[model samples]
Target: MPTAVPVAALDPTDPDAGAVAHYGDPAREQRLLDNAAGLVDRSHRGVLAIPGADRLGWLHSLTTQHLSDLAPMTGSELLVLSPHGHVEHHAVLTDDGDATWLDTGDAPGLLTFLERMRFLMRVEPAEVSADWALLSIVGPQTDEALIALGVGPLLPPDLLAVPDAKFATGSVPPRPTAVYSAAALQFGGWARRMPYGADLLVPRPAVPDVVEAAGVPLAGVWAFEAMRVAARRPRAGFETDHKTLPAEVGWTAPAVHLEKGCYRGQETIARVHHLGRPPRKLALLHLDGIATDELPARHTPVMLEGGERPVGFVGTAVRHYELGMIALAVVKQNLTPDSVLRVGLSTAAMDPEH
Candidate 1:
């Protein structure tokens, strides 16, 4: 992943300022993210641009979300599933008037899949990761921070737009095909609510200017991960694996549109939703004894107290400032919320939050 801007432009004393991890005081950065506002360089996230008239319709028939009527300047999320209904890839989707934007952790793989499925569709997909930069402005004052950076007006009207009742109409106005020029600043970029706050997609060359203008402390990936864990948000690789279904990780409502037209994994999703329950369900595990600093690593076995057999495994674990040692785990659906489990060497009780 490339650095958003020059390291010298940021605090030099904070060694990891331009790296993937934290800069200096991770705890202090986490506090700023929770209380005020902080900027995180997410340029590593994959970005793809899909242009042409058939973009929405083509993507609508391939992904789980209903994108055929996706309106201009609005956003939604979708999941690409295997034929048997397991989630293969996930993307955060939004569209300007002329083209659609797909953001994911695996841009190359997504681009390859889309290209292979193009057939005769008018859609043309191109990887634009090098051309754009993604930054997340999180916390209660996220909007204020963006305004201070002079990018507030670029955000869509409803930053928290989802694929639910609010956007049921699915009507989008026609947009002109124009290059992303200075005049396009009002609608050139896209912003959407994240688990921590909201993310802004901007031009790559302007990242340094934006960071300097924001004047807020920069946070590392560790702080972002902790906040995401606290929010109980399951990411693509950590909480989900190859055979993982959407319902297993609690992604059904927002990422899956059951009532929409037929898609690759629609049948399996519908069958599981209407007839049976997923084999596993997501849960929040509260580790016992906060005194110990050691936390269980990912994929550690989660077993029933005094039982010889393992029931589940940990996914994302973090030492949250407020929640202490908390982790998200995928456990057997049969296990009740009151079940006591053992994670690594520590005892854990399942929290009802998940």
Candidate 2:
């Protein structure tokens, strides 16, 4: 994919792929969380555009999230699972009335699966990441900020699942009214994001115009990941293993529609939530014992303190501006939060809320 024009001016020698990790500011996290005008180059993220008459219903039958009657400009998430319920694909999508855009970390893999599943559907899935660039500005005032530039106020997904008064098994609940909408511009559009921000989708050539006019602090992935990890947001590669169930990482609360009809891996999801506990659970680890900046990496073994056997592994690790050294970890479902845990050699405590 061609680099976004906004950050294409970055020094090629600076690593972290093409996204401008930081511009000499270690306090990037603080500035962003404080609602500083922020610009993040998320060009590395992938996008797939599916435009066809049958897009909505066709997708509704394949993923975990509900979309059979998804309203225009509303955003929601979905997951493609193995027949056994392993999370094979995850994407946050938005419907622009005409086409549905699937934004994900692994677009090629998602695209391949979609192509195969399009056997007789009217949907045509194509990678649009190259044609479009993704950017985000996270904060309370993000809506007004994007409006000034004429991009979006992308509608955020319903974070808290509210059941209908008369809801029952296999019933579709009433769709909630959207409080936000993406701005339509000749160059591109914007979509509200979950947990905390708005996503900007624009053609590559329009990148410089948006970034220059954004007039906000330019942050890197470091700050974004810090916030995400702090919020206990479970990402695909980080928190999901081949056997991961939606219930394991709290995704079911936000991403799974319990009443949605059968789809791939629905059996496993149903069986796990109502019949049995997931084999593992997601947790936040506070590495209070760490004495240095050096932290454990992804896939690092996590064990009960003073125990030799491994129970789980660390996912995303970050040293928050206020929380100090912390990491999101996946551990045995039976593990107690009060129990001491070890991430590598550092002793830590688990927060079971995740």
- Candidate 2 lDDT over 244-290, as tens digits, reads 88888877766777777789999888778765477898888889745
* Model 2 alpha-carbon miss at residue 179, Å: 9.2
Model 2 spans > 4 angstroms off: 1-16, 34-37, 151-157, 160-180, 289-292, 352-354
Q: List the residue pairs that clash in candidate 1.
A: none
Root-mean-square deviation per candidate: 6.3, 4.2
Model 1 per-residue lDDT tens digits across residues 188-242: 4756555456677889888877777767778876788788887778888778777
Cα distance off (Å), candidate 2, residue 205: 1.1
Which portions of model 1 miss their true places by more than 4 Å?
1-19, 151-188, 289-292
The lDDT per prediction is 0.75, 0.75
